[model samples]
Target: MRLQGKLAIVTAAASGMGRAGVERFVREGAQVAAIDIDPAALKALAAEFEGVHTIAADLATEQGALDSIDQGVAALGGADILWAHAGMPGPASVEDLDMTAYRKAIDLNITSAALGAGRVAPHMRKRGGGSIIFTSSISGLVGSMMSPIYSAAKFGVVGLGKSLALALAADGIRVNVVCPGLADTPMKLGFTGRSGDPAEAAANEAKVVGAVPMGRLVKPGEVADAALWLASDEASFVTGVALPVDGGFTAR
Candidate 1:
């Protein structure tokens, strides 16, 4: 029970890394507030988990991130950890990008993560110390030929984590970011726009997998494990890291 007695709030909790974090944190004995825009999935999580509280809200705006944390603090008594992660891939090319859509997508990927962590910092500080983890991407660690804007947003997340780590060190709040490669998640399917076509989806996934040295996609649980470690007392001395759970994609 590494996180026993801890209270945590995770964004994007309906699926992907968010859902996995909820499951893992609860299993390790943390009370959690699961926030997402998907009401149905959040409802299901609340119904299944004894200590989970669900909040359906978009994390793409400053107000949205703040509102979720406010409700979360009220529900969980206080928060000891924050997995301040909720984002989606934006346009694949610079030419295809709609500036309006770009702003919204970047808000979700970078702005919300930074705002959410900032809002939660004080609450964690009040508890003496707490962990704050952001979900970035391997694209954040390196340039992406296919998604330059999206890569920029992910890179911003890493910068947020590093800066916060230093700013909150004296408050005993540790900040870190997790950079994941292609994972078997809805985001990947949506990125390819082939979620409905099994054959096409498989082909796309295969291509994504082939680029990874591991020959497979990273699992949600694996990324969750990394976040869990950073959130636990086991990582009391660790912070400001852009840890990659990317099957060694960045190494290449």
Candidate 2:
């Protein structure tokens, strides 16, 4: 019951770490507003959690991000936590320089978090304090040969988290980033471009696992556990940290 009676807004909440976070927050007694681009998945999430509010919106735009937060806050009556977890894999590499994909990486991964934080902060201030969590990647800390665009966007997220943590401290708002390494989620397949070839997928996974000192993929729930701590009162004195749930992947 770490988050009992709390109100939260989670983006990309239909699957992976976002879904796990929503489930954990609710189980700990929080009423949540789950936001996702997938309407059907949002519906399923609403069904799974009787009291959860679900919003389907594309978060890559300023209006979309702001509107979702406004609507979520209205639905929940107030907000204590905003986990801006929506993100997408950018182009496979930077050699081609796909401007479309590059812009998308910046928008969906970083800009949306900024907009969401701006919109949610006022609501949080009204409630005395709040937590703002962003999802970055280990790529944020280090360069990624696979996708430099994704790396740039994720790095921006880490910077945003630190900057906002300092900017919002006076309002009792804690801003932090969660940098996940090679987790067992759909995004893992996304990183490898899950084609029909099973061998190719397995090979890619093995390569990624080989880089992790733990020699295994981090679980989605494990990332959620880290985020849950940030969202709760236990982290009251914590802020501006880019926590890595990377299973020692970053250690190397």
Q: Name the candidate that leads on lDDT.
A: 2
Q: Once superposed on the true structure, which residue ranges of model 1 sit more than 4 Å away at CA?
A: 194-201
lDDT of 2 by residue, 1-252 (tens): 999999999999999999999999999999999999999999999899889999999998878988999999999999999999999988877676888878877899999999999999998999999999999999999998777788999999999999999999999999999999978888787786546587887888899889998899989999999999999999999999999999898987
Model 2 misplaced regions, further than 4 Å? 194-197
Candidate 1 lDDT (Cα, whole model)? 0.89
Q: How far is candidate 1 from the true structure (C-alpha RMSD, Å)?
A: 1.6
lDDT of each: 0.89, 0.93
Q: What is the lDDT of residue 161 in candidate 1?
A: 92
